[model samples]
Target: MLPEIITPIPGPRSRELAGKLRRHESQNVTYLAEDFPVFWQRAAGTNVWDADGNRYLDLTSAFGVSGLGHTNPQVRAALVAQSADLLHAMGDVHPTAVKTELCAQLSALTFERWGAGPGKVVLGNSGSDAIEAALKTSLLYTGNAGVIAFTGAYHGLGLGALSTVGIPFFREPFRTQLKEFATLLPYPFGPAGDMLRLRKELVATIQRRAIGCILVEPIQGRGGCVVPPAEFLPMLRTVCDEYGLLLVLDEIYTGFNRTGALFACEDSKVVPDIVCLGKALTGGFPLSACVGRADVMDAWPPSSGEALHTTTFLGNPLGCAMALAALAEHARPAVAAQVQASGQRLKSALEKMRSPHIWNVRGRGLMLGVELIKADGAPFTDLAIAIVTRALQDGLLLLADGPASNVLSITPPFSIDDEEIAFVAARLQEYLTALPGSIS
Candidate 1:
């Protein structure tokens, strides 16, 4: 029962709030639109209501932050219970029982999935923090400052993580301030021949550089939900083993059943030396973890009064409790199956369209994308934006992502009903069919 457009998007109240926010909020952080941005008042499951009372079906899952869905009941209940008991604890100085239990669960899960042997975890408040910890771990363990990263990769926005980010626009502004410790390489995304060339290049770089780690996204998320060849990850594993380099998989976006597998790396049986997890880690709370093999994590010297890397909010009791609940909910076999089935259905529908505008439709499980193209096969960024904007007006929220911003990222909640999926597909088809310019 979505598409409840009671008023124009960003209605009067939203517009008023936007004007007020503009006066105080920094321009860099605001996602300003023409009239006003859609101000969310509340959300539940896969539906979000704006300040104007327009209920839209969220397709992007609030940038993949709410995998268990917005305001998930289980996570909310955990948050309430934890808040009533223990609200805050000094991170790194005094860890709470909840933090210990959460870490133990994560370690056990990592061991069971990757056979990494009772891995250890370092908690953080965001995905960028997780990446920072992973980077430091690599430096300490391998004693090499150089790290290998892939093109179109988005580790995070913090200085440490930004140093390794592959996106030019995201890194360009802070290039001079950031250290040049990462070597960016092309990600293999095409046929066997293309993958082989990329693999050769990667090997050559490893030989020439003092690389301590190879940091990568199992399936590129912000880079348009790009899914590399199935062999890509397995090849990376082989190369890492050959070069004695630690493999760091950033599963911040692809974890928590967003991909068909619990972790996209699991599909290839690739056990990374370090795994950075966040986004959906706490359902909707700010929590992240840098987990890895015990030996690697233990490389850092024991704290002699001053810990090297620790945050103020490192495993807040509420976040940890919510994370525990989220993990349990996401671990259900039914949840995983639903994601796989829904993704397959959506991808199949897009593939069947055979529209001239669609260059490709690819992704794994719920992390899907539709790459739009012009008649000449060039990326149609304008068309992609138009579709997304139009869908919003129709009460179907969407997002455009990719190097050229020509891919529609469709990452709905795992709990989204089949009817909602069908509605999204049908609406997309209708819009594409009725696009202003006819195919030449």
Candidate 2:
């Protein structure tokens, strides 16, 4: 029921709106260049209808936020019901019943591996704040100021989270201030990086120096949806254990049945000390949490200790209530199994393309990537942009990421139907075929 492009994208109304928005926004980073910025009028399960009445199969899922689908009925009901009851509560000082219930669900779901008395949950408004909280927790637990992060991994943009950012372009502006806190390591991907050597280097760095923790993305999101080698996480776990450093896994993108498994870490049986979750955690609301081991979380006991971290909107009632519903949605075994099956189906379709512009298709679960290679076998940055632009024209919504922002990241909602997936793949093929170079 998609591909309803009655008018060219950015029809008169859309153009007018984009022009107005341009006045109040930075055009460089906002709109995709080729197509008109179709203003969204409404959205439903896996599809978005623009102001012009043109519909698009939402492949990116609003940057991985609406996992259960846009304005999901359950989430909307929870939001409406909670808002009507009691909206605000003092977060850490005074908590509500919904807040306590939400935390109980999160604790019950996560600490299944570690036979736990009680794991702690600290709430925040965004993924970045949750990550920043984890960083502080790590520092407190180990009583050290140093941390380790991998190349091409994106944790968040806050000072503490940004310090662990591996991309030079994102970190270069703030490097002068961030260098004193964290060390960067090569992520175990590609052909050349030796895991054993990297492991030894990490151990040496953490043991000799005052390293408190190592932050990693269980499945890199902003970094081209890269799924590092299978052994990579377990090796890091071993290194962290040996070095006495807490392992903080950022599951902002990989959690909530996005990665086929309950959490991507479960695939390898590696338990991290601290886990940061966001994006789809609250279905489609602004909620994030840093849940971890008790000893690590209890680093800041409330007796005259410098208030380690606190956000104004922490443990928001509406957000918590919505998250409770989202987690319940995640718990359904059907959701997890469907994500794995759909991911494989899409991956197989991409692999069958045989396009010369494609370098390779890599990733897991609903999160996948089509890495572009030039005719010379090097990365084709411009072509990737062109492909995305062309895909937009064909009524498909896809985006690019990675350090270069050259890889086509295909993260459709987990709830997409088979027909919708086929349409997306067909649109991609049409775009590739229209390019000048031969695909085969």
**Against the hidden reference, what TM-scores do the models get?**
0.97, 0.94
Instruction: Provide the clashing-pair count of each candidate structure.
Output: 0, 0
lDDT of 1 at 122: 92
lDDT by residue for model 1 (270-354), tens: 8888899999989888999999899989998898967899988988999999999999988788888888987888777767765
The regions of model 1 sitting more than 4 angstroms off are 191-193, 437-440
Candidate 1 local Cα displacement, residue 271, angstroms: 0.8
Backbone clash pairs for candidate 2 read none
- Cα lDDT of candidate 2 equals 0.83
Find the 10 residues in a row with the least total lDDT in model 2: 28-37
Instruction: Quantify all predictions' global Cα lDDT against the true fold.
Output: 0.87, 0.83
